[model samples]
Target: MEAFPRAILIDLDDTLVDDSSNVDACWDDACAAVAPRLRGVGVDRLRAAIDRRASWYWSDPKRHRTGRLDLRAVRRHILELAFAELGIDDSGLARDLAEMYRQLREERAQMFPGVIDTLDRLRAQGVRLGMMTNGAADAQRAKIERFGLAAYFDHIIIEGEFGAGKPDRRVFEALLSAFDVAPGDAWAIGDHLEFDVLAPMRLGLHGIWVDVRNAGLDGRPGRPHRVVSAFTEIVETPV
Candidate 1:
């Protein structure tokens, strides 16, 4: 743990980038689009309903679409389900709202504090850097291009392009293999405990989970190596 890792892997959303900012805006757009259908419900109430339904759908660990590799389909499905819950079972309406949300969200995506500097420093130190994120091709690529993030990474592996996702040892293994680095000589960091940290830990990589939400780590195994509340901690000593 004293030596720096030879290769480094990082997550996209909430780790190196603050994707929620645009996601919130996208939800605002969705609310505006659905306001007319809310008969008696307030905009705030319908927004909550849609968010809850979408969250419920994506929170299913075993659901294939939860990986969000196909953002268009998954998001459309989420809105469709939400509409059904609100007695507005119109697929066309759901599709339009989903497309609107995605377009706005991608246009407004922003990186987290110090992401560029941190990645630059790591790359300067000869650390092999890779971005292993689960997202749709266009949506995820838009973020990389919008923020010029591709300059910092030696590998940009999106699950949509790679055909695999985290928690699957194959995805973790394939990354290290591509870099020709052993798991023990690499580190993987992300916002999600299981997908980013726990899975990598099992693969012999030093997995660090950035719990930006202040989620307590109690009762979980300490194999994640480290858990911090900020993204800047990635550059700290012994990372």
Candidate 2:
């Protein structure tokens, strides 16, 4: 563990970027944006309803897989359910609200602190890098371009492009192969314990969990090779 990894496979959302952290805030903003158009519906009430429906929608593994790929449709469906719960019957309004949320999220997207510098240092050290993300191609590509991430990576695998995503061994294997680096010489880093850590560990790759929320393992199933609260820590000596 003293030596740096030969290669690295990292995740996009919530790991290097700040997208999921602002989800609720963006939802609130979207709800407020459409408040004037809602009849007899308070912004707070609508937001709460949408939040509840969204929770239910993502709780299922199947829905989560499908929903992440088509977030707009998922949001529209969640809004429709929220509308039904509130006795509002406007499909057009629901669609517009979903699109509003999507735009708000995109406009506010940002990378985690020091991510650019960390990636730069890794590249300077001759560490092979790959980005493994699960989302629609356009959405993932937009973030990569916006943050100038492509220049730092040797391989970029989006679920929409690969036709599969993380926690699926194939995606992880493909990335390691792309770098021509053995699993033991590489690390999988991300916020999601399952997709970023356990999945790659299963393939003999070191797993580094970026606990950006400062949330400890708290009896989480698998053990990560290392855990740090930020991306910058990966370059430093292991704690």
Candidate 3:
């Protein structure tokens, strides 16, 4: 165990907030809103069909690199599947649905349990906080605002805004620069192994993998510098 780093970088989705729930709700809303246009398409059935296509797009080896899926593209692919299922011949509808989902998603931002308390403790301990996420600026910003999380972060970097996504050192570099700290002086906490852990590890920073589900990595050779299942565990463990 070592002393906590001077600064902390956190991922948004599934790290601080339970975005999966928001995403599910957005899908449901989209299905209901589009139902009339879909005519005989049942909402539940449509949701299930869209989820299946989105899951495939996320898990497909050809689509994801190092198992890191781009959420924006996943949204588009899901909409495309929905349109195809309903025999809708318009490509523009896919874009429209994606945009609609983004709007709904921005409106629903729920913080995970213990996020605020942990963040408050960390800030009081004199640690700088920053956010690194892979999503569009508008949706991400809206979530931060709705959840009242924007004031705590010294820096907030969205990958889509920078024209790049995670698993890339450039994104991490941007955060480091914003914090005016070197990689060695900071730690990155994220739930995803590929994007959050391995990506920051490449830049010589400490990578703390938040494996809340306790799902073991499959044949992964090396482990993260630190692993925690809960947000409070961060303060107990050496950063």
Q: Which candidate's lDDT is highest?
A: 2
RMSD of 1: 2.6
| TM, every model | 0.87, 0.97, 0.77
Could you tell me the TM-score of candidate 1?
Answer: 0.87
Clashing pairs for model 2 are none
The model with the greatest TM-score is 2
Order by lDDT, highest first? 2, 1, 3
Please, what are the lDDT tens digits per residue for candidate 1 over residues 107-147? 66677778788788787788998888887778788788888
lDDT of candidates 1 onward, in order: 0.79, 0.90, 0.78
Better model by lDDT, 1 or 2? 2
Q: Taking the tens digit of each residue's C-alpha lDDT, what string does model 3 give over 1-239?
A: 34678888899888898776567888888768866766676778778878888787777755665223355676776778766876766677677778788778766656788889989988988899989887667767767888899888998887657777787788888888887888999999998887888889889899889886778766876679888875567878454
User: Which segments of model 3 are wrong by more than 4 Å?
Assistant: 25-38, 42-44, 60-77, 86-104
- In model 1, the clashing pairs are none
| Per-residue alpha-carbon lDDT of candidate 2 for residues 136-233, written as tens digits (9 for 90 to 100) | 99989989999999999999999999999999999999998888888999999999999989999999999999998999999889899899998889
**Worst 10-residue stretch by lDDT in candidate 2?**
1-10
> Which is superior by lDDT, 2 or 3?
2
* Better lDDT candidate (1, 3): 1
